[model samples]
Target chain A: MPQELFNKPVTELSGMLARGEVSAVELMRSVAERTRKVEPKVHAFNSLDEEDALAQAAASDARRAAAKASGAEVHALEGIPIGIKDVISVAGQPLTASSRMLATFVSPYDATVTTKLKAAGAICWGRLNLDEFAMGSSTENSAFGVTSNPYDLERVPGGSSGGSAASVAAGEAIASLGSDTGGSIRQPAALCNIVGLKPSYGRVSRYGLIAFASSLDQIGPFARSVDDAATVLGAISGHDRRDSTSLRMEVPDYRRGMDELRKSGRKWRLGIPKEYFGEGLDPEVGAAVQAAIAEYTKLGCEVREVSLPHTKYAVGAYYIIATAECSSNLARFDGVRYGHRSKDATDALDLYFKSRAEGFGPEVKRRIILGTYVLSSGYYDAYYLRAQKVRTLIRRDFLEAYKQVDAIVTPTSPTPAFRKGEKAANPLAMYLNDIYTIGVNLAGLPGISIPCGFTGGGLPIGLQIIGQPFKETELLAVARSYEERNDWRNRFPTL
Target chain B: MPKPEDFNLDHVANLARINLTAEEKTRFSSQLGDVLTYIAQLNEVNVDGVEPTAHAFPVVNVWADDVAEAGLPVEDALRNAPEKRDNMFVVPKVVE
Candidate 1:
């Protein structure tokens, strides 16, 4: 079994494949076996197209062999395996936003992100489960089932990218791609104890990713190492004609930044946001994060108190903007033009009502109602308009704070992964879970959560590094410095 | 803070196009109402005269040209609908 391949970084695996240490088919099976062994406990997949994945792997191997034979340059991602979030499109594969409405639906074409991955020689191993349509904080809203936290089976892995996070955390996949809209990726990364990066909003294309909040959604990587994350981001980051919002600039060589940091002795200025480590945080997790910060200080980096006054308004602004976009984006699924329609209906109105009624889950319905309420004609001036105003203020606050500081720090989550039903009973508690991370998404800056420490219960705590827009390289430098000092990459949950 | 009782479950259900029993409505109303009230605390923030932002960082005119490049064929697009009756998306006729 190539299962030893499971623990290697994606770059190492890619190098092994090129050197014939293991074939693509061999690596694919190794991951498949691991997925089979651990997925029942993790509940990470919405759909696992094993046959397709292996076939793609075989093709990638053939291409690499052919390229090597011909002395031609091979695709950097040859034979690499990636887990796609359910929210991203995978051609000829099911693209259920985890909603029952799209339960049986398959995407006709690949999203721009998928296209890039395929072109770069990576194989899409499976579709990870997510909160239906990327709505909820936990994968509990998944039409299929909730993904249990790998750290503790009965607890939730933070979501709606929970499956993506858990899959990577549990070694189901070497790397998985997830979309972050208001902390979807970072929060789950914290809970699952993986490195999750929310790229600057336009750093990656949003064309193929199902819209959660159009403005905030950005595709990013969840991997075990900072370099692995950088490698995958390099493969997927580029401009696309399909997504107008895709950045026009050339993708920076994020790996090169690592070399620069190494040469410069890895010194970084850390900014600890006084606003973040306030009262509501779990003290154990707070100690872990502060400990991580203290290491940065001891390493010759200055730690200063930075204030982001408007950090308070992020969740509020995010919900309103995200909801309004969701309200508009989801309007197309009115049983008239889409995947699910009511079985029996006397009229069109009844059909629209019954179809949506039966298809959407409680959370989806809740977000839809909230979005509709905010965007509805009469109340738009009050709710939607006001939220937009607050959104601006949130962005300005981040810009203002970044001027005084190089990067802002936060506890990736307020608490460690909680029991499955612990906060399931209350939506507010669930939203509060994302408080530390959402502000970054609201400001459209890049943020990453790397496991810094652990709780007494053994769950991991994440240290967040928030950077100015497109400063992913800098953010990862800080993360890598800490990761090197006290490597959390080798830490594993005893399943 | 947002009003909890003001959200009759009927309004939420109607807006969301969901069928709800009285018990479900009662449960969801309190649940959703609590969620909204917590979220509404942002209003007290003195965002007065401060412009509300729609996207993070700076993005200007990030739209593609309106020219038709290429897209999936309609046949492929319709492949996922659980039910489709015509070239167009067909639903129960409600216009009378």
Candidate 2:
């Protein structure tokens, strides 16, 4: 079978577009057709505008022609179609965040990352679904609908970036963007068998990203290959004055740096955190990650056992900190300004109460209440403050480990994608799904989930590579080393 | 450490300004109890002499030039408003 244009990575698609071998419109049509075919079963997108995508592609083609005539340099991502998770504003597009609260809301301006992608000449494609306000581990929490694992329709696409990961895995888009607050991006990418890179906190601007947990939230990319992820990361990263937390450091040429590092044949000192491979880890997933570590050992990299003692406390701290931030961030969703309003409201205060009651889903409400409680007067010191102090310990654990290792390798998720509704009833059970991935967020480190191997059941398993703060260059190179030696990136879902 | 059984669903919900249905209140009370119990494990860790990390890499004292820049036009800003009148969001009467 011929490789469809939709499945090609951004790196390859860019070369094709530059060579005039394939038109941007042709790629857009291929992606649109693929999305239309599989979207019913995958349910990865909340909304897509094919006509608008085609128009954007046409404009890209026109720019390419002009650049050719004028002997001007073309952007690296010119004409590539990338999906936007619904939480990020795309100016005039629906920014629902997969919640009923913003069911009818449209963004009035572009997110900083959106502006960056557009400037790179990429087509801002579909509005992908996510857990409402990015509060859950599975896409099932999304008010729009659950996004299914392309590998098995009965299973979930790990979330709250489930739609972003699913869309790429299903060839619905070349790549997509997702927000990672407590493993939203990496978990989904692991479940979907793709590469998801969560840059260090403040590495990517969060100016237009709908706040989930203000401190933990960082926007990242989901792509089929590590190289493509690098391409997307380069375009979207850097300082944005609009986002006060955005790092002011210079953005490196990641692809170039990755290539240079690869050529240098640098021997990486990889850490295997003992806590990550412990109880609750599926045997199959464990074997796959161990095999990946063995592969690193064979490649002449030093493998050492490192300890992140605070690992066990990550979930507890994350829920407290994230929910507390979310409770504050989501306060803007009251019916007073925009989003769904309660016609049943009688007075001003009643409006805030009823409108929120009607607009938010059960999980969102649960989180808000929990968050409010933690920040409430008496419990503040016990919960919120204690969580913050634990967070410091968590960050310190990683910093201590990095002293002995170039990067830490672990399982991206405890298990492969679970059957839909398996843990939906138990929020605590679902929270454990992100156990291995959340500590990276707490430490503000760059982490990538790449396909390591698959289970006997044919479900994909991910090997996570956690790098030092602001060290994405080394991280991508490390991930790329594993990717180059493995055939996992070549396989795709039959659906 | 606060126990899960002590979680006041009604009080918290009221503080959050969300009117949970009877069913939601019942379901969340139990569901969140499990979560709160899980969160209680944090108390086990000794945080003595540890400074709370509000942000992983806190960028302190971020200042921008105090110059007026372009703001969103009123029409565009009010575009998503559930109720709008003359380029302003119309909310339920608060003063009355």
Number of the top-ranking candidate, with lDDT as the measure: 2
For the predicted complex of model 2, DockQ is 0.89
**B1-96 in candidate 1: lDDT tens per residue?**
345455566765677666776776777778777767866776687656867566554557666667876676888867766667675666565566
lDDT of 2 by residue, A1-495 (tens): 257899888888999999999999999999999999999999999999999999999999999999999999998789999999999999989999899999999999999999999999999999999999998988999999899999999999999999999999999999999999999999999999999999999999999999989999999999989999999999999999999999899999999999999899899999999999899999999999999999999999999999999999999999999999999999998897789999999888999999999999988988889999999998999999999999999999999998899999999999999999999899999998989999999889999999998999999999999999999999999999989998887789988
CAPRI-style quality class for the chain A–B interface of candidate 1: medium
Off by over 4 Å in 1: A1-3, B1-5, B57-69, B94-96
**Best-matching candidate per TM-score:** 2
Candidate 1, residue A246: the lDDT equals: 70
Q: Native-vs-model 1 lDDT?
A: 0.82
lDDT scores in order: 0.82, 0.93
**Candidate 2 runs further than 4 Å off:** none
Tens-digit per-residue lDDT, A261-367, candidate 1: 77788556667878888878999989998898888888888788877787777777777788889877887777766667878777877776777877888788778
Taken in order, the candidates have interface RMSDs of: 2.3, 0.8
Which pairs, if any, clash in model 1? A97-A133, A348-B93, A348-B94, A389-B52, A391-B53, A392-B52, A392-B53, A443-B56
